[model samples]
Target: MTKEILYQKFGYVLDDSLINEIINVGVFKSFSKDDIIIDINQPMLYIPLLLKGHIKILREDNEGNELLIYFLEAGETCTMSLTCCMGKSKSKIRAVAEQDSDLIMIPVQKMKEWFHGNESWRNFIIESYQIRFDEMLDAIDSIAFLKMDERLYKYLVNKSMLNESATLLIKHQEIAEDLHTSRVVISRLLKQLENEKKITLGRNKIEVISN
Candidate 1:
């Protein structure tokens, strides 16, 4: 996509000169479905701007179990940028393309330069970090204050916004990991919801039946 188009898509206004600078240092890359875009514990290099498709951020626990953290849609930048900015060598998060995806890789130094030179870009990054920070706080609050059923309900509501039909094609284990609960608890909660006509489960899909 053209620089103007990308800026428009991301809701950022950039001058022609700044756009040219970004284009000079950015490289476009495509990944197939299920491809690993960023591996866990790898050296920080370039920050990715997702132009198309979906990516999932994940990590493995001490028991070697993979946990799902969050999903990134189109027009979102990778969390690696924020982590790297905080002087982290390796990221605990791994990024994988859930579908065939196109991304722009911006060198860290180039981004730093733009961030320093452009007030708008710097504000954008700061706002993005603040939003992520708030989300982390909310997640912690959910874990501490909400019951398993309530947590599952909230997740279903959030996923329903992304998939309007109330059906979510996500794995049960992934839900367990994201909620920091056991798979058995998730299964029981899902079954209870189904019994109450609150939700229905199909192969790899959960449909919320109640509002």
Candidate 2:
């Protein structure tokens, strides 16, 4: 529950003074699996620092098509949300807990002050932006270049990796929503993958066979 342990997860060794300052202003929060932590078009209330578990960052098109942009695990932050907060604007991205997660939230004003007061904090902010930007680019490439089936395959692999399990306990409809496709298309591709001996599908679970 302490920010000290949270910062340590990120390989940051904050001295007692700085740690105390952060603890004074930040609030710790825990989320259940699939919880919507931040909604699109909402005001940015707190800058979240992921302490444990994974969070999926999503972007929705004007027509309501949703895409998974990236995942933030322990030791990371959401760059898109940070940018929106600094600009004093509404959020354009949505963040959801991919699993049970714990995080610390630092208010907007304190976040700004920390950049000037703490050197490590400033470096983390810069690194977070660069890392998230590269991930956004990868998401764009997947949507633009990869075929639907290919994308679905990669998505399954990624999901398995994220969940740390080869057997994915998820529904076809949920996968379709994240990939911005229809359940029928996902079902077709999944069947094809099964026929090809790449994966084995069960009632609501997918087990990877080859890759």
Candidate 3:
């Protein structure tokens, strides 16, 4: 998309000069579905501005289990990664492409420079943090207040929404991995959901019929 379009989509206004500065400093990159954008414990090199498609921020345990923390869509920048970038610290989470995606990578130096030089850029960063912080809170609430079955159902609904379809072509093992549970547990919960007429399960796919 054009810079003007992206600015509009992201609800920001940038003059030609600032736009040119962004164009000059940002490197465009693409990733396929399931591609790892950021790995756990890796130092952040660049801040990503997602231009198209979707990504998932994942928190992984030392035992290699992963939990889906949040979703980053087009025009959203991941505040967690940006935090690591600013601090020059290693990442505590992983970022993965949930679908084919295009993004612009702003080098750490330029990210800092923009924050210092542009008031609008600083506001953008602050807003990004607030958004992600709220999402993290929601994640926490889900874990604290919701039962395992409820969480699984919510996760499937989220995936269905993201895919823009009621039918999701995914395996129970993958769902288990994302939810940080065992495959057998996920399978049992999925069967329960199916029996409740909330979803219809196939060999490797699930079709949401209700909540």
Q: What total of clashing residue pairs does each candidate reach? A: 0, 0, 0
Q: What is the TM-score of each candidate against the true structure?
A: 0.84, 0.92, 0.92
lDDT of candidate 1 over 1-211, digit per residue (tens): 6565467646564566766776788888999988999887777778887777788777688876675566777767765455764584776777888779888888877777888898766776777677667766776787689987988988788767644558788888868876667889999999988888888889879988755
What is the lDDT for 36 in model 1?
A: 91
Q: Per-residue error at 120 for model 2, in Å?
A: 0.5
Rank all candidate structures by their TM-score, best first, as comma-separated numbers: 2, 3, 1
In model 1, residue pairs whose N, Cα or C atoms come closer than 3 Å (at least 3 residues apart or on different chains), thus clashing, are none
Q: Which runs in model 1 stand beyond 4 Å of their true positions?
A: 2-5, 11-16, 85-88
Candidate 3 vs. truth: CA RMSD? Answer: 1.8
Q: Rate the local accuracy (lDDT) of all candidates.
A: 0.75, 0.87, 0.87
The Cα error of candidate 3 at residue 103, in Å, is 0.9
Candidate 1 positional error at 42, Å = 0.6
Which ranges in model 2 have alpha carbons more than 4 Å from their true place? 1-4, 13-16
Candidate 2, 11-104: lDDT as tens digits: 4634456667777888889999999999999999889988889999988998988888889988888989899989999999999998899988
